[model samples]
Target: MEPDIATQNDSGQDSESGLSLRWSARLSLTTRILVVNVLAIALLAGGLFYLNNYRDRLTEERLTQARLQLTIVADALSSGDIANRDALVEQFASHLGARLRLYAPDGRKVIDSFELAEPTYQFVDPDAEPLRKDAARMLDKTIESVVFTTQIPNFSEPANDVAGAWSELETAERKSAAVSSVSYAPDRTPVIVAGKSLPDGAGSILLTANARDITRIVRAERASVLLVILVAATISILLSLFLARTIVRPIRKLAVAAVRVRMGRSDEIAIPRMPGRRDEIGQLSRALSDMSAALRHRIDATEAFAADVSHEIKNPLASLRSALEGLERVDDPDLQKQLLDVANDDVRRIDRLINDISDASRVDAELARAKFEPIDIGKMLEQLLAAREQRTSNLGVHIAFARPAKDVAKVMGDGGRLERVFGNLLDNAVSFSPEGGLVEILATPDGDEIVIHIADQGPGVAPDQREQVFQRFHSDRPDGEAFGKHSGLGLAIAKTIVEGHQGEIRILDRDGGESGACFEIRLPKAL
Candidate 1:
């Protein structure tokens, strides 16, 4: 019916659109990656910040518990606790979750439950230590000025009533001995020491709090915080991927639209839009549509104008030819001859115009339907040479054909068209050659094509004009000049015919064989 391809093909092909999308996607990748990474980084940072705050609060709560435990041991050891200093220190160590040591009034260790060393935690010797004053100041920071005894009555009051029963012991050691009840070992675990005077002033009381458990819990809490940060980073990566795709989809559509517009198949391109988010792509789509519409309109107008001009010119030529035929039938001899010449000139000019129009119109068809067949190029040239030599022998020009090897110079062409092309070349050579000069036809094979050189011993064309000599209405000789009635379309028509046969025709250098103009035609061998 209408047309098979018209029914089959899409309004715009996907190949062009797909290529544009691929390039646009590549161009956008840098910005897309940046945006995705930025969002992912932001999410990671937020998660890390939350985890840090949570760990900070938890550690603070644990430290607060440590502080309260420190206070109970301090209050208990500061008062005289029991008759046996060792028994009292042991009891205080259990309650305070610490190590204990009791020092006598002379600073000798009287009872030691927790082992003490010099480097990490040193026993406070009020007399020998150079840092005793600073150490006492440090002690004050750990101890409360007044005891809020209600929080841990079990350890605080029992140890306090025991020290109260040893009032005589308090006199020698002073409150310092009871304070020395808390001491240090090699490691830095805060040891609560309850130091007291034994009822007979034998020893002091000490109690200590070990800090290793609290340290382990702190490290574990930090690890938990890092785990939360890793989880947050993973979530952020996923979210960023989603956002990047959403933003890139519309851009991809715009890319496809541009390709469709460039292809000139359809002006209709639909762009996805958000009502309130009319952005750059929306403006671009509108602009492209307008341009496409304008181009289509201009092309239609041009075609119509060409058809009208062709029609108008054809009508005048027809009328002019009819008038010339009427003039040929007149009785006046002189006027008839003059009118005939002018009419002939008009006819030739009209023919050139018609040929130009025909060539321009059929260019598409010629290229598409061009096919080649085997042609004996040397045989064809020799035959033409024989025919022309007999006919033009009276013109004083010699026709020569170079015999080529049988299969070496085989050509492929339209036989009739090739004959006309050589005829035009022969006619041109005959008109231009000097008296007794040679016109030669030589055939040689060149790769996939056969080269035929037709050389005439005539004045070669000017360098600049050699190429234009094949254009319709282009002539080197003037009207009624040396060459008789040069229509100027012979070479033009020859060139078209040769090209329609998928061959090339050109002017070649004429040096070795003869100093003349050489016209070369190259045609492919038939498959």
Candidate 2:
């Protein structure tokens, strides 16, 4: 079978139809922002944590070294040289100011700085407990394997106004109250706790370190890390905002194009395909191009058909006016009767011609949206037979509705149009049917489709001419082929009206059905 002309429909529909321009999924602006921010923050946090950890370790090593240096110096002073002990400590403290703390064995002070008279020190003995001081606190109770120290600045003895305070210094070995904090507080002497042992007048010594420098370095490093993150965040936020704008702009264009397509203004879309983008936008552009090409083809065909319709209808209208002019001058009784009848026939023919042109033009529309109401094929055929009997009684023709459902054989179709469709079928059957011959109407349901077979027992159409009879202006009448007798459009009109309701009406084999020209109509019950 030849393909039917494709239909184009406006977007009017019921609530069941879910046609629109919007596409919704989990993707949104908020989601995009959240993803970007989370990733940025995680990376920044990781890098900052790593560097802060390293700086803290470095500060601990430096403080440890300084405390070891103090031990070395005190050993030298106790061994023999006390003359330059103060000068030596002053030099060490000044050079290693950031990690300096000073104390003697039994927790006595030779010099103090940073409000640390006697500060606690960390031990790594595994069994060592915290020693409280009124100054720096120990973060780890066990002594570390190595000592690290940066020397504190030089110190001067308090003047006469503080002579009593100075005389009270280091008189007894006493631990201070709880140490408050540990930091890089400048101008502080190194904190040192030494254990002096005398075995047969020979000397032994032990040493410990403070945590002030490690704590201070961590604070400084954390601050610097925060600054870096703030700068990175600002740049990321600006870049993300720009990226979001770029992404959303193309999406908006695609949205408008989709809306135009849904609105039947398919020709209006010219999607803006950005250069070098091979993502979703490129795919969408290709799709829209295909849609536009399809629409343009339909628009061109419709224009051409409109032209053909205008040209075809003009001839009949002119002929109709000429016949009316000729009938106006008739005067004799019998001649007037003949002319009036011919004129009336011309008017009817013109009406039929107009209706045919209109119906053919609307074949697509009807196929696209025609509502199928319940109709009885048998009852409709009965009505057709009863009406055509008056015209056929003189010709000795009998037309019958042959069926399985009998009078209740129902089909779904537009009733009035189906009436016209079958009326034409019966007329064609009777025209080619022999006198005293039978025209049969047969129907059977085939799946979701209904097949109706209309056949006659007269001379069947030739194989070559079977399909030709349905074209516009073709005819099968023997000789009543007057100007308006069979305008060669009856079968064409029948075909148009049938297919318009989403049905296939074709001329099938006559002999295959036991005789004559067999025309079959196959219609979907509903789609």
Cα lDDT, all candidates: 0.58, 0.58
For 1-527, candidate 2 gives per-residue lDDT tens digits of 42232122455433343543134234576457756775876678665446544754565465455445544554555565556545554454445442233344333344433233222332323234234321222321111112233323332323532212222222211222111112322223223333332222232222334444554565466567667888877777777777677676677666766556555554555555555678876777667766666666567667865665666667766766776777678667787677667667767777776777676667657656777788877677777667667555326767666656653456677887788788877777877777788888887777877788988886777889987888766656754546665556667767877766668887777755666889999877543
Q: Estimate each model's TM-score.
A: 0.40, 0.50
Please report the TM-score between candidate 1 and the true structure.
0.40
Runs of candidate 1 exceeding 4 Å displacement = 1-333, 352-364, 387-396, 478-484, 497-502, 512-515
How does residue 146 of candidate 2 score in lDDT? Answer: 20
C-alpha-based local distance difference test score of model 2: 0.58
lDDT of 1 by residue, 169-204 (tens): 354256433332222222322333333343354444
Tell me how many clashing residue pairs each candidate has.
29, 30
